[model samples]
Target chain A: MDIINNLVKNLGDGIAAGIYGALGQGLAADILIMVIAAIAVFAVASGGFAGLTYAERKIVARIQDRVGPNQAGPYGILQPIADAVKLFTKEDTTPAEADFWVYNLAPIIVAVFATLTFTVVPFAPGVVGTNLNIGAFYIIAIGSASTIAILMAGWGSNNKYSLLGAFRTVAQLVGYEVPMLLNMLPVIMLTGSMSLVDIIERQAGWNGSWGLPFIVILPLSGLAFLISGIAEAGRSPFDLLEAESEIVAGFHVEYSGMKFGLIMMGEYMNALGVAVMFSVLFLGGYAGPILPPYLWLVLKAFGVFLVLMWLRGTLPRVRIDQLLNMNWKFFVPLSVVNLILVMILGKVFVSDPALFKANGGILIQPLAQALIMGASSFVLLMIALAIVTRRVRKDRMAEARILLQRRETNQQIAASVH
Target chain B: MRTDYAFIGVTLVVACALIGVVPILNYLIAPQTPNKSKRETYECGMETVGDTWVQFRAQYYLFALIFVLFDVGGVLLFPFAVAYNSVNLWGVIVVSLFVLTLLASLGYAIKKGALNWE
Candidate 1:
């Protein structure tokens, strides 16, 4: 029934036929396809989002070598559902003095933006809301509304902690956007197309002939992106906004029940959305051929998701001041430098148009440059890592020595007293 | 993903319906028993009229300002970065010069303490 309806809808008027049938369908066809796509994406987004929450907890537990919430339903699979139920059944507390309009508006605005990412974002081959020419722009534009929503949450609640948290989140996300976009420059530059499909289609190979995957070849860009990306998601090492130990649930401190759950789920959904986008950009979205493209898409998205989880499990939250310093003093300049470097390298490297067209969007010149870039960046990165390692080790040893000295002095004093 | 208005229209409709459903659900599910205490603001059970909206530090503004600057910089350069494959001497120069302007603005902002936190 669905397939036949979809087929019938696939034929229609000018926009419906021409625009909608980019997948070769009509107006009605576009609508049917869109409905199916929405249902599929919404389901996947929700289920994946739920699973992600469970996964993060389990990963954190594993890294700490402790059993996580495994009792709920076979390795805590049902824990997210249980949590959702709990939140829904819990008290719905609205502050007496709160601004009713903005308070109500905040979560609605957030959830809408969170789901908006799905429209331009293709989950599989020819399956999306609207493959606008301005797909990338649409994602960014829709994403900006989230900042406004956070601002609304803070102001509506009339709480200092909420306001501060909202401010911090806004700041962090805004700060991270630059480096994140900068990181994408090399990929977009390589693809020579703004469309996400074009980006992924460029990375269609299992083994990079010239270097590792464009993603790995551009490790600095990826690392910078991931660092800021994690910040953008408000996860560990950059989760100063929530800082549960300090701010006590941050901007939604006064929120409870379904409103809070909606907000929380909305955030997780955004994280999942970003993970998918990152995979499409850097890891070749839905590209593996043996399995279906959607399977490959999920796999790549999960792979990116794991990176975020891994970082969360391993790294400590940075101080607020340190976070600011890192963004402004380090990441800002670094991203600019990276953007410039990629631009220069693009000219120096990808000079062959025939080769670029022959090899589907990527130039052999960029591939070669990527090889050299990877090797050199790896070496420089290793040195930096070593320096950081040495400094940390020295600090640990110094602390140990001080502790020993204190113990020995205490022992001597006891012996003298005896 | 074809860009069509009708398809977008359907999507917007569904989203709107979902948005509308929430408020209806809230009214239905919420236990509304009229009571003066329930409606009163509770901060240690005191009287309701007070300022809960305290102004925050200005450091956050600096962070936001810097963020917008950098994000705009990224947005401006993405096109140029992607178009750099043509191996045109002039194209490369234009990008460098464009990026330089952004960097110069950033540097000036830093110098002026626009990025500084109190």
Candidate 2:
């Protein structure tokens, strides 16, 4: 019974111990364990990608009031497998004038970088593939590098639409990346660590209960991060990079067969990475009651993924101009202000050792501090919302005036003609 | 720290191998029915016009510039953020001033209409 209960908790350590025992604690054993861990993370990420695709299709289908993929296997559960087989067997095509090497290499780069992000993520206590000190920063760096791959796909395709898509990718991805980086600061400030595991550990309450998630404290940063994350993953309404109507499949327009599949896989993997990162950073990763820790992490990640799909199903893609404007004019400024606010709040409430110790230990002190921070962030959000609302209303009035003027001129022309 | 990074290095190599192998497998299994039209650049069923290396608008450069500034700034702030608890009031003040400078730059960019998509 204890083994079953502790099985998921100590699974990683157990595997490592078993390998060491078998191999007599040599360097070979360490290397073997690392390789095994890598493969395991790769497998989980790939499996999550496949499941995400199926879930997205089903959820979007239901949103559209249609039955989706009932034929593949038991409610189209095996649809991703069928899709994979079909893609693998399809004709691979490359344009004659395309940059042959880079065209072929971009998707591989995408797939590799997308999968690499899974390394620092903590699935359970003591179950990370690698607990890098700079895990959070490492993720951002990897995400930015993947942008270069998309640019390669676009430039190498030798297609106008692909080039256009690549341009939009730079504008959208880079613009949103600022706010995304900025939003992460508040969490880091409160937790005083950049490692995801440390952040998670910081959220544990006294007596091992669930402590206050950062989202409760820094709602503004959480909201900002989620929006920017959606854009970074290229989901709607921020998916201007590959808006099919405008750019015709964006950066990977020239890819065919499994190369295209690889890019698609990379994208879903990225979405999963973002979802998992959000859960780890803000949702008190792997910390919940009455369930395996890893299972809790997975559940939170899926919840985030479903929310992404819901947004995809409902929101229309924003125009490129609207997208960039929203990022620069709104999110960037908001995130900057949110970060400063959080820094000041942290200094005021959490800096004093005496005050921190006096309050009911780890859980209660942070909770009190977070309550104040949360209220301030809520007020900041409202102020920002009011400003945006006023700006939008003013723009609409000017637009209405122009339309009315145009209509009157047409009416006057009609009267003169009559 | 070294061992942890070794895990990452191993995972990276494995991930590369896994992703690299798939395309090779596709090449082996997938059909090769190459033809003139099939290999042509897709332009919505029309002949390809100008070169794909058309000059893009300069507006994208401005966003790139802003991104670089903010990205570097954010990275600089990370260490400060992580060490926020142990730092004295002066540290917090210095970081606030740094953030204020960033915000000032953003404001200048907005005023100059660098963010305008047009």
Candidate 3:
């Protein structure tokens, strides 16, 4: 390695090498490396999502113990590529009765949001496409555009199924985004930055774990994030929007070829971004040893993606009414309680930064804090369950008593009339 | 930001490249025969008539209305978290009250059964 470096150093022109003063040269090299990292991340993310669409189907199939897409290529390795080719070559047809402009643009919105999300995601320390200081905000803003895009596709498609699917999407998304945003609040509270890179960096360091787990510090909030993030990715038991057989593929009912492919790919991209975001927030993004940080990050994100698949495959799609009920009734209350706990946590800890500092290498003050958080969560969940369960049982008992009394009254009336 | 336009360019290029490969690939594997009727819009074994575009429910507007409030409320908390350490009691109260207001609205929606679909 030393010989190769010296040999390469000697081969460069004298003026170019001299202008590359140690400090200046390092700066220029860093910029070039940043550019390259950005490019590579974008390519891999796009291709990776395309590949993941295939993987999603395959994994879901295997869970059901079935062979999926076997005839395409070896182990279905070429399946995504083949699928892409087929979609592209197939005729781009529009319904004669459809709104052509919005129809064309609608498909683009779904694909575009999918691609644009790569800009804010960080694969490793310096590998992010662009570290917008408002990275989290950017994701929410750009990500929600797909809802409008989906709406456009559905409306423009001129199919009843498509319109119904589009409306379902608008409802499910609007419902789920409530809790999704509420859940994400605590992580930003702990990290104190919205940049994806900053959040990950705060959780990780050059040599070792941060010792403090985001999951530990903000437990219920983290779980809420998981629940809402699952919904955000449109997986079950929150996938009523795209409930196949019932909705006939929903709003994309009329779309075919590349247009359909774009919407499908968009779903996977949202999943990818969300899985990574979930990891960064709760799982200590890239906080591991023995493996390069980027690899660790992918492993963490992949783990989340698999959990999503497991959810979609195992749980039945929740009823639309129950889905909205859970959001408004359950998720809303828990998130509120969690937010209060987060605020209290912020006041107790952040008010005194000294507690977090290294004092003779002994972790200070946070152990009790973590225990209090745990006990608080256990209490809240139990109380919520107790309240909800009691109310439900009470209602059922009341109904049963009513039926019994009515039966007795009817029998008495029959005897009197006779 | 430069990556944005570069990606658009790449996708266009990829689309073109894939288009070029299809015919050769098709010759090697499958036959390319076009039946005129295949391109027609399918409508449950019936000859399609009239415009496909139709109006849908306006009720999603209610969902959208609730969405704006909560989604905006979610965004509102981001900046608050950044400056949380420096926030005073009044600041906390302000945000708390804001959250409380949203909670009330949600309760009203629930009681009125606006969230129910069936």
Candidate 4:
């Protein structure tokens, strides 16, 4: 295990060296290295889908107290391979009225966009692809393409269900994106950098070597981000795009053979990409004790993914109206407020030169600031809960009163008639 | 930066090729026996009705427009947020007022029931 860990840690350097040797060092080497990195990222994104499928099945099975996919080679680890082979061998079909160009292009767009997000995710200290200046917004910009891709699939399929599914997807994904972007505002404010690597570095320890992750400082922001991001990634509870019971496989209903496999690959890759982003933004990417950097990142991302599978197993899918309402009415408002609160609180307390310098850069004040933010957020949540419950109770009481009054009036009329 | 674009361009082209190649591989392996009924648009074993391109509700357009408004506004916020620490207090105030406007618009939208489902 230790040897494997060491080997994994050195893999990036080994690949870089190999590229340099092949291309000769300098500008040419840099470009060639990037090409190699891109291919590696693509492979990881596509292959990660198979691993995610296995992980999701096993985790959900464990949640339900049942074994899953154990028949196909050692606890079904090879199940995805078998599934892939089956898909490859299955008959490919196109609907008579389908728009062939758009139909063919949609899955390609989805897959490419999904892989593109991997460019910005920092697995370790030096293991990032490009770390572009606009790293944060780049993810959002690239992610929006999935909406277009799904629209293409739906419209091009010439299936009513697919079109309806595509519309729902656009509505849901777009709605959730607002809150997701808003939720990241606080993280950016605190870190003072849009780069993922910078965010992680800023989150490193104030006094001691151990860091306080962004989630510790702004739990409300983290919570909001994760919820909306899950919806953005089209996971369960927001899996309206492929709501099997309702839409008959949804936007990709007409897709078959390897095309269908490509769509599924896109789905899982998007989820994995989001999970990596979650870790980078909130959990302090590549910052942990004892473990290798990439290993820490993988473990943290896997932890997030496990939570996603747990959510899939425990929660039922929400109605489309309910999904939109949650995004717009609840999450959007809450995220806005949370962002404002963090910006204000962070500016006044945590970033103040007087308090921070007076304390000689001790970690105590940062911890105190985090506690204050957490306490205030909790108070706000409780107050909101109280107001909502009171409103619901009043509505229910009024409804009951109306029912009773109607019954009395009916009884009086009956007596008078008699 | 130019190199970064090169990387992205290569990745995209390769990814597209990979997606295309998979289906071609399947085409080579899989049998093709297309029939008239098999080629018809799928409607859960039912015959074709009217055209499948039905117009969606206007609400979707409303959401998309709202999303565009907020998303573009949010993109503008990222620059200010990243430069927050180095900037002066007036810079903070300016951005705060900007965010306040966004919040006010959202609140107005909610009060007008733009987000209501019913």
Candidate with maximal TM-score:
2
Q: How well is each residue in A1-418 modelled by candidate 2, as lDDT tens digits?
A: 4465467557778888999889988889989988988999999999999998999999999997889888998999999999999999988899999998889999999999999999999887777888888989999999988899999999999999999999999888988899999999888877778998998988765223647688888889888998899999888888777878887888888898899999999999999999999998888888877777878999999999989989988888777878888888899888888887887676666634564654322334555777888999999999999999999899889989999999999999999999
Each candidate: what lDDT? 0.69, 0.87, 0.70, 0.83
Candidates 3 and 4 compared: the better one by TM-score is 4
Best by lDDT: 2
Pick out the ten consecutive residues of candidate 1 chain A with the lowest summed lDDT: A4-13
Q: Measured against the native two-chain assembly using Cα atoms, what DockQ does each of the candidate structures obtain, in the order listed?
A: 0.38, 0.70, 0.26, 0.60
**Candidate 4 lDDT by residue in tens digits, A1-418:** 5555566437878988888888788887876766677788887787788899998998899998999899889888899999999999999899999999999889878888999998888777767777777787888889889989999999999999999999999999998999889888888887777888898887776325658888877777788888888999899988998899999989999999989988888888989888888998999988887887788988999999988998999999998977887777777777777777776666566535564554322324566776777787767667766876786589679989999999999999999999
Q: Where's the lowest-lDDT run of ten residues in candidate 3 chain A?
A: A355-364
Write the candidate numbers in order of decreasing lDDT.
Answer: 2, 4, 3, 1
RMSD of each: 6.1, 2.6, 7.0, 4.2
lDDT of 2 by residue, B22-113 (tens): 98999999989899999999989999987888788998898899888998998898898887777755677788898889889988999999
Task: List candidate 2 segments past 4 Å from native.
Answer: A206-210, A351-364, A404-418
Candidate 2 docking classification: medium
Structural similarity to truth (TM-score) of each candidate: 0.81, 0.95, 0.79, 0.90
lDDT of 3 by residue, B1-118 (tens): 5543443344434433433343334434433354655545545446667655555566667767777878777777889987765665456668888888988897887788776666
TM-score, predicted candidate 3 vs. hidden true structure: 0.79
Residue-pair clashes per prediction, in order, are: 9, 0, 0, 0
